[model samples]
Target: MATTNSLLLGFLLLHIAIHHSVPVEGHPNYSDALAKSILFFLGQRSGKLPPDQTMTWRSDSGLSDGSTANVDLTGGYYDAGDNVKFSFPMAFTTTMLAWSILEFGGKNRMSGQLSEARAALKWASDYLLKAATQTHGKLYVGVGDPNSDHACWERPEDMDTPRPVFSVSSTNPGSDVAGETAAALAASALVLQSQNRTYALKLLLAAKDVMDFAMQYRGKYSDSVWTACPYYCSYSGYMDELLWGAAWLHKATKNATYLNFINSLGANDITDIFSWDNKFAGARVLLARKTLVDKENSFDPFRFQAEDFLCRILPNSPSKTTQYTPGGLIFKLSSANLQYVTSITFLLNTYAKYMASSGHTFSCQNVLIKSSTIRAFAKKQVDYILGQNPLGISYMIGFGTFYPKMVHHRGSSLPSISSHPAHIGCNDGFQYFFSGNPNPNLLIGAVVGGPDQNDAFSDSRTDYNHLEPATYINAPLVGSLAYLAGRYGSG
Candidate 1:
């Protein structure tokens, strides 16, 4: 008991120190942060590099991704610091990016990140299209072996590791991954409608086919692709994804079939999160719009659930499920906590607009709160991520003068090909992974797994739980940063 208490006391004292040497502020160049966040994806890019590839550090990688499956599975963002291309999170990344564009695209343009954001969205969407269509009634859920890839720390550029492709067919259905891909296609279609109407329509139609497959052959992708377990497993079940995909289909196509399916879903549980694994919260948010725009009686449950989700996440609400740190960061799971922060902040921005445009107010524990409050709370959280915390460091790489230098991304850690022509062998890369030095290449815009419950951060490459960056982490943040920059910041 004394030891535990002593440890606790020591932690408290150290936390109070709060890295005072590191200067920090509430806001610093939101536009710059937005741009860097978009650039982060370039570092995670796999397969062939384009001529205009800005992240010159990352060259062509995983070119023969789907060669094992005899299908082209090149050109998608890596799941995280690793080279393995997990399709579930990749689809969620696309869906969130598209949703951001659909909501705050103008703000993104004002902040001078619209084109990059569009390209980022297209980059993932194009791969999603190929994933769903290339398999011929089958869905390619993942590429590369997680166990082997994780064991070796080499950069994707020279991946000598096994490039096994995993897919789910009618016999082995993966509703979760397929549904997510469908959602990605639908949302991307809406976002890219102006850029290429014909392509957008093609995406919408493909979304329909994939969504139908998900509904027709119902099963979890994790079940089919067992290797994905303990990584990107489907925790909340496949129904949430099906409903999410159906909602996006309705939004894009406005087909009565989709509307009927959503109304039939009858998911009343207020989702606690919107992340790579769970889609319930996102489904509620999207379906809520149906009642607002169409004034449909069938969609009232979704609106109620969506409102409940907001109330549950708010600090003032009696039913609040999300916990906040002393530094005002949204503290959820102990690991990769920033994923929830980004997801919820995006939803708050989206739902806040919905409430403001409709002049609607909701009762949180019978206390009617203004939509502005949610937006304000969201800003505080975003500001906390940029800085304004006890740690006084930006979780986002390249956002501030002092940020994460030891991001747990393999490409960022290894010496760039330009700098060192000598190849770092497979296991040899672990030396860099464990090194205390900063990564050789800057993973700009990459949002790392964030601080602990006490708003403490470890700037160690070995501490992947708190230092690794991901594509999904940056996807939802694009619009939030863009909106803040447009509405408030000079940059």
Candidate 2:
């Protein structure tokens, strides 16, 4: 009996030594720092924005106010029965910022920014926790302001209800809730674990439950919903949310169920929803490449399809160029659609990694522009902003045609007005248009211009100086500028 026990002990020690010695797969330089930053930040903080930055944007108070400060509008307009307001877009922004901070830490450890990153993580986590608590496990994806009547369904009046000041619509109900919540919780769990917080395990378990619940509601092919309209379907958003959640869960728990879920989703046909207007399809493809990189299973057809779709959109030649002008400043779109700084950055950073691993390139013409170009564009945009006065940079430009076009309202008995010209502006351009004809849906925000211009402006020429500081227009603009500044730093 003694000899048998000794043999078992020796085998167990050998197994442990081997496991410890093996380098973990997917150990990218950025991932380690990201993990550390997220863990540290979560352990140290809780609800509320850090004491440094003040919320200067407009508030959505009173019947006359049409804007909500610091919030992104997803499901616009609301009425009665829909008493809840979904704040997923705002939630998403927070999640992305938190993820960005962690990812950035993985690559470059900027000293002073650690606190800012920590603050962002804390703010986002609090927001998510509050949302979860408010919903009480019943997912309310976004928040709505009172003015916009809920037109999400056929009968807006029937669903109208007075609850919070914000509006809640069923249009794109809970599409990203599960994925986003999972990401927030996963990040928090990682942050807490690193600090040796006793509750880290519990947070992780809770996060897993949220993720599982979300997965259960994913569409037939495992694609996530953006809204009730099929056109609003998002490719990259869902995939990123899912992969990030799954990857973190797998890493933390090593559970085969999560791995299997990822594989099943990967194998499904997700490209049927692709459209030219949104680059979400492209983004999803890139995300899929990231998710499938180290998997042992044969490369999924959807993964290849995603690559093929990207190839279809690629400019014919690397040398070919397009032009972009915004706020009267002209720039060259040397890489076609690849000009969008964030999109290009994601492609190069992610797709390039995939190319290196697969020993395959998506054709020479389709190769992502180098990281240098992305950095250059970001820098140029930053320079333009710094050159202008704070208010001068307030405009937001609308890009694709799918974004609503401005229509002049005559204020006739028929209700609202229609038939406005479709105009594109620079990143800073802002335009207000109805969500639908006859009745105003809600004013939505969009970024304009093709890939090359450094100038950002609104589609309209009117001076917005008279607009209230607390207006909705200012909040997103502020957030966008803040995001851009963070990405490129003050030039």
Candidate 3:
């Protein structure tokens, strides 16, 4: 009888989530969180800083990024605290940011962050437009050398590092990076469609061209550009990117060919995870949208895969994967753990919305899994990120009373160009890097690579694994924050 009562109570909560937003007690101001998350991009921006750029500490740098190759790869984003502009993860970041607006754009609008989101997205897309169209059948994978850049810790403005232009062509194949970029362009195109149709069409065309390159010349990007190895290597291979790219292309154009491509995906490629390195799970979740919302029976396999992932993530399910900290944080990896937490939570919130709005109930192990429970779990994780954890620290910089000040970012650590106009040599900035003091300038809004399995964080600038903030870590998080901000409006 006690077990029966507990089940009934769970179901009641789930039912409420379907009809109303679950009142997440102690959730930090989500709208504020969203605003701050968007602000992080301004700090991460590469190339010429806009006049209105709020991250004043960040100055124009990497202006001559592709000059060696005589191609202008000036924009996009820096991959992490280090200055390399790796296309694979950079493209993934753009896709997630655009996806956030696509999912909860209305919420951003209400919270007055829609334009900021679009602008931040445009910064990357504009760079992508330049990067992808540099040559026909050629896609530049990265700019700047990670080893050399890591050797010297200087501001992007003051550094005189060797900027080597890398690419994957018909001869040097890299389907993964190409396909990921295609997906990014397609996702961004969708976001810009109603806002700027002409630009959207231009992006859609670029996506098609890149997707063609990815499909025709089949190979891993990291394989072609050996430099990217040991860093952003293609761990799960190129098949996932090809499928993930096709899904986004289908989304942008409703092209049946792309759908057929996704439908024809191999069973081996199916998985229940999403990350910069792997998109198999993200692909499943995206394709499931069609099966659930559009009622496309052909995409049923992906829908089932999506449900499997949900069951594992939802703790009450019998077959659930035990991947949580004692504090209820969805801990996956020890290093940069929040990446998994944010990305997985985004899917949970996304699927929850899809199910609730479509009036579909989720079942696991012959038990009902309410959309509310999924989102409630998602919210709990987000709250942990925003200062409800054992550490009582907000992992997202600049959102709460206390955040990590020793963010492992070179630009943020050194004095701004405006302050210290004197040139700091490429290698002379090690003093700034090793300093025990907090970063001179805050990397406001950067979602740092978070805590250990025990929910403990080492807030040291030297602790790159747990302290370094990356583009990929913050991207999917933008979508999650926006959705929650909208759900818990004006509160």
Best by lDDT: 1
Residues 128-217 of candidate 2 have per-residue lDDT tens digits of: 554444433444444433233232221221222233323222322343456656655666666546554665665676667767756665
Best by TM-score: 1
In order of appearance, the predictions have TM-scores of 0.94, 0.48, 0.93
Over 4 Å off in model 1, which ranges? 1-26, 107-110, 293-298
Per-residue lDDT tens digits for candidate 3, residues 1-491, read 99999999988876654333333344468888888888999988888887999888888988998999999999889988988899999999999888888887884343688999899899899988888897876888899888888888888887587999999999999988998999999999999888899999999999999999998899998878977888888998999899889989998888899877766656355454678888877878888888778888887888788888888777788888747788888877777888888888888888888888778887898979888878888888888888877766788888776789999999899999889999988777888878898888988889898888888887899999899999888888888888877777545
**lDDT per residue as tens, model 1, 1-491:** 99999999977766543453222224557777788888888888888999999889889988888999899999998989998999999999999999988888894343567888999999998898888888678888889888998999998887898889999889999999989999999999999999999999889888999999998998988888977788898888899899899989988887899878876777565677788888898888888876766667677878888888888899988888888988888888988899999998999988887888878788988877787998899988887788767767888887755588998889999998888778888999988888888898988889999999988887888888999888888899887887788776643
Q: Give the 10-residue window scoring lowest on summed lDDT in candidate 2.
A: 466-475
lDDT of 2: 0.37
- Kindly indicate the candidate among 2 and 3 with the higher lDDT: 3
Locate the minimum summed-lDDT window of 10 residues in model 3.
17-26
lDDT of each: 0.85, 0.37, 0.85
Q: What TM-score does structure 1 among the candidates reach?
A: 0.94
TM-score of 2: 0.48
